[model samples]
Target: MDNVISVILGGGRGTRLYPLTKERSKPAVPLAGKYRIIDIPISNCLNSYLNKIYVLTQFNSASLHRHITRAYKFDNFSKGFIEILAANQTIESMDWYQGTADAVRQNLRFFNQPNIDLVLILSGDQLYRMNYQEIIKEHIRTGAEVTVSAIPAERTQAEHLGILKVDEQGRIIDFSEKPKDEKIIDAFSVSPSVFDRHGIKAGDRTLLASMGIYIFNLDVLNTILKETRKSDFGKEIIPDIIKKRRVCAYFFDGYWEDIGTIKSFYEANLKLGSPSPSFDLYDEKAPIYTNPLFLPGSLINSCKISHSIISDGCFINDAEIQNCVIGIRSIIGKNTRIQNSIIMGADYYESASHIRANRFKKIPNIGIGDNSCIEGAIIDKNVHIGENVTIKNANNIEQLDAENYMIRDHIVIVPKGSVIPSNTAI
Candidate 1:
């Protein structure tokens, strides 16, 4: 691990997760009421003792840059640091990162260090806890030039993921990126014995889907990037390299979800409120790290809350919240009922003077107002929901884009800093 470096790809625009990605990069999106999406990967790296890291991004990176700078800092004694490498134009190339492979290609000069022997490539928008040293050790033992971490996924899950075909020696012989054709997917399915060898239950999940996690030998990474014009790792690099390089598959049967869409993001957040979540946040040995705000404890006044996670500095007065994730600095007024939603709490508390001014202007405060009903929605950071506002999509519309909100996959999303007037209904 001492000779390894980690690079988290945060370059995607995350169009599927729009509204959330409207102001910040995908990795900077808030998760589980407290931590950012980028924290998961960086925490995994730190826990694995692989500390030298670089985060590559291009779109809406101001918040991402700030969060990284504030959260991850190393003492001068240790050679551990986390740096953000935004897309830039050099004399050699004048374009932004075209794809994942191209993002790494553009930043090769930084990764081409003498002490770095192995490069770990990871996706920033995933929810998982992995000790990367296991994969690194396997890569070394198998003498694999490129190792891809794969998980057993069922047919429905494999259709959206990069499916792989592996030999008996665990070498990936073929790969397909999001193949919709049933024949192609079936051709890549692994046998039940494969799962047995890894001590995992097969259950209907016969195909091995790529987790978009990779461990590459530094020399091979340099050679491939220099020789090819491929832009993406899954769509181009991995598929092309399998025929020429020793690309192996490291089976990981853990809880992992690619938070790529509005629905997936909503469901993943709600899952955390369950009694036993698949992705554990209570693991002291491998705890997730985030910025410390030093906020006061929540003030709950007779609120009927159940199966919910309320963060720090919340003031809930006579509200009913169930199966929801209430973020930091949230305020819920009286008679409000919120269920199956994610309220990304405010960044700053409104001063008394500001609250009075807002009252004079007949504007709602920076939180849920009294007599509101919000269900199956994501109210982004710093949103102001006026009194008597109902946000439930009663019509069951699958997709819609309105002035203040948008519905995708049947979950309403109120973008950051939005204001919903009193008595508004959706």
Candidate 2:
């Protein structure tokens, strides 16, 4: 892996995951109580022994930059470094990153170094544990110029992903970028024997969808980017090169979920608190890495908690939490009942003086106050919910944009640094 370099694309304007992406970038969104979304890919690279990494960021990247700087610090002897390549305005290109391909093209000078043989492209906002060495070795063995990591996806799931048709040798022959037409999607389906050959169970998932992961030969990538003005890899670059270059599919039958939208993000987090989660966070061998906050264990005072993940430095007093992910430094007051929700906790604890001042000013303290009921919602970081607050969507409205919260796909999302006063209802 010495000759390999990894580039993680921090997505542009995460509109689907808005409110969460309102202040921070998509990659900086908190996940499973403790870790950030970007931590998943960076930890995968470090575990795979691919140390040299560059994260491409464009929109609302301050928090993401801070987390990366604090979490990853390598010694001088290891020759491993994780660098951030933020979008810049230069003489060559003055506009922002038009798409993923454009983002890479703008930063090609860094990746086009002599020591780097292959450039591994990854999405920053995905949840998965992958040994990237396996894909790189397969790329070398097959002599493929480009290799895309693919996963078996069902028909309903295929409409939102880049679907590919592969030959017997696993070479991608035909490609479609998020085709909504059922006829086109059905034509791209793979045979059951293909799944059997790979030892993956072929249930209803017959189509091989791209996981938005790619490996490209240094020379081929430079040549392709120089020849075309294609702005995206999935929608333009990958589909265009499939007919001309040696593009192959690397099948991955692992637990991978793209946290792109509110509905997907909500479900993915709740699943982590399940009895048996598909994405494991307890694997010691390939452990996920994050910032080390030297905080004390949670102080639970007669709280009834079931099937939940409560992070460090939390203080819950007589609260009933079930099927939820409570983040770091969270404070749940007495008689609060939280179910099927995510409470992203505060960054800094409010001192007694600060709390007194907040009370003087008629503002709720920086955590969940007493006598609150929250369900089917995502409470972002540093949110203040006062006593007698009810956050459940009683009307079952699918979409809404209010002053304090926004509802998308029937899940109410309280934006970061928001405040809901006493006796409030949603």
Candidate 3:
């Protein structure tokens, strides 16, 4: 692991995520209540002792830069280093990242060092916990030029992922990028006995899909990036390399999700509050790390909270919060009901004097005001919801841009730093 380096690819524009990516990179988006999406892969790398990490981001990278710098810091004596490689224009190459392969090719200078043996390519906007040691060991044992992490997918799910076919020896034979034809999918289906041998129950899925996680031999990566002009790995480089290189698949039977769309992102965040979440953030063996905001515990006065996660430095009074995730420094007034939603909370706590002043001036401070019924909404940071506001989508609208908020997929989203007036109905 010491000789191996990890590169987490921050995705492009992230149009599918929309307003969530309006002001920040996809990786920098907050997760569960306090952690960022980038924390998942970085934490996995740290727990695996792969300390040399480089995060590649392009759009709206200011917040991503801040989070990476503040969250990861190793002692000067250790060789561990976590760095960010942003897109820049130089004399030789004056272009931003066109795709995933292009992003890594742009930062190939870092891999020129002599100590590097392999490169672990990871996606920043994914939720999963895995140990890379097993995959690395399999790569070395099989002498594969590249190893890709693979997982079985159901029929509908297989249409959205890179599907692959492997021989009995676990060597990749062919690949297709999201094949729609049922004949092609069934032709590449692996046997249930193959999954049984690996201690995985085949369940209903038979097709194996690439998890967008790959391990490349240092020399192999350098040669491919130099000779091939492939823009993407899954759609281009991988398909070409499998024919010429010794590519193998490493099966990972765990909870892994690509939080790419607004609906998926919203659902993934809410899943954290479930009684038994598939992905555990509290795993002591592989804990997720984030910027430690040392705030006081939440002070709840006669509030009824059920099946929700409340972060630190919150002041809740007589609120009924159910099936929601409240972020740090959240302030909720009395009789407010928040259900089936995610509140990102405030960046900084407002002083009592300032809140009093706002109240006197008939302005609401950050967070939900009294008697507001918010159902199925995502309230971003620094939002001031006025009193008696009914935020529930009354008409079941799919997409609409209101005065200070946006609705998508029948879910209302109050963007950051928005202010809703008192008694507003939606």
lDDT of each: 0.94, 0.95, 0.90
Q: What is the C-alpha RMSD of each candidate to the true structure, in Å?
A: 0.9, 0.9, 1.4
Provide the TM-score for each candidate, comma-separated. 0.99, 0.99, 0.97
- lDDT, candidate 2, 315-383, per-residue tens: 999999999999999999999999999999989999999999999989999999999999999999999
Write model 3 residue lDDT over 1-426, tens digit each, in one string. 888999999989988877788889899888888889999999999999899999999999999999999989999899999989999998868999999999999999997678899999999889999998989998898899999999988878777999989887788989989899989888889988777766788888888999999999999999999998889999999999888999999999999999988888889889999899888878999999999989899999999998889999999999999999999889998999999999999889788998999889887888888998999998888888889998898888999987799998888999888888889987
For all candidates, the clash counts are 0, 0, 0
Report the lDDT tens digits of candidate 1 across residue range 296-325.
999999889998899999999999999999
| lDDT leader | 2
Off by over 4 Å in 3: 352-362
RMSD of 1: 0.9
lDDT of 2 at 179: 85
* lDDT score for residue 285 of model 1: 94
Stretches of candidate 1 exceeding 4 Å from the true structure: none
* CA displacement after TM-score superposition, residue 250 of candidate 3 (Å): 0.6
